[model samples]
Target: MKYLLRYQLINYLRTYKYVPPFSIFILIMVVNYTFVPNPILNSYSFTSIMLFFLMGWFTITLFHAEDEGQKIITILHSKGQSAYYGSLFIVCIAIGFCLSMVSVIYPILIGAFGEQPRVLHIIMGFLSHFSLAVLAIALSAIFTRELVKNRQNTWWGVLSILIIAVAIVTLKSVILPVKGLIWLFPPLHLALEMMSSDDSLKNIPYVFYWQFAWIVIYSMLLIGLYFFILHHKRKL
Candidate 1:
């Protein structure tokens, strides 16, 4: 398991999928903070739009690494199927947390340089972004697995882009059972609720806690689904 993890981490660093999205994220933050004086508005804009799409792309690329044929065989044989996937889940969680923290670093630095926001708000934002990133990683794993199963490797990037694009455009009008379904999408739900509030500190609203709870629940469900898919694929 340790060997497999080390190999994955090395591959992740070498391929450098982390670079482009992270670079864009930093660029967005710098531009917003430089041009727009209000730190609060900058944070809100970052979380609402740039963070979502960039993180989604990052998640997809990370999981897509598993599609490399030789590496997949090496993981299965050396680590055993279950241990290989268990290690992967851990890797994904760690990567998600790290990437999410990277996403928030600019905001943290801006706060440090003056324009201090409530500590509680910063904590909640960190938690929300971390949870959202983990959930995105799990979903991307599932999507990548399905694409591999169907032998549709060519569509991987295209499908990921389309999914994010469609979700952003249609999320508002989605209603009823569908609205309930959309709520399961952590990025959109968290962005809408957290950004909508005027009070970031003094009155830490009930909706923040409510959204956090849902994020935790949905993250668990997605992680479970990721493991189940791995188990089923191992059998076949």
Candidate 2:
């Protein structure tokens, strides 16, 4: 597993697919610092949106890397599907954590943010952003794997426009309870509520506990489904 992870990480570094997302993250930070007196506030406000897209793109690219003929051949010769998926999962989580730290740690380091620094707030923000990125990657992996199984190419442009439109249109509506459906997506619920509140630390325990639990549940579910798909496809 370690060797496979190292090989995959080196491949990602060589391909430069990770560059665009990190570049965008840096750009967002620069713009936030330039225009906003409170860069941390801007980062907190935008982290959900930024990470949603960035991690999605990153996951898509990583999954597609397997589609190349040479890479597929390498995977077959290695420890096979288990090692491949495990290594990919580790890489995705690492990328998510690194990208999330830009929003969490950079703000604290600069000391130009909103309220006086609270340890609880920082911890909660970091966990929430990281979990959100993981969720995005998990969803992307499922989508990519299904596309591969069905022998269909991704239409990223169309999917991007649709996602943006739905997010914008439902941003406010998602807050309102619709038959308790809001609880179904814990990450989105927590992110929206957290970003909306000026005093996020007040209810930190409740939000943090639920978000953490949901992230674990969601990730396991998606990953399990991904392997199930792979198994079924192999049988066919």
Output the number of the TM-score-best candidate: 2
lDDT per residue (tens digit) for residues 42-137 in model 2: 357567567767787888777666556866786786788777877888898898888787777776676657566577667667776787787777
Give the poorly placed runs of model 2, Cα more than 4 Å off: 39-42, 149-153, 157-186, 200-203
Clashing pairs in 1: none
Worst-scoring 10-residue span by lDDT in model 1: 146-155
Kindly provide the TM-score of model 2 when superposed on the true structure, using C-alpha atoms.
Answer: 0.83
> Which lDDT tens digits does candidate 1 get at residues 71-108?
56866577565676666667767766775666556666
Each model's lDDT comes to: 0.61, 0.67
Candidate 2 lDDT at 118 equals 74
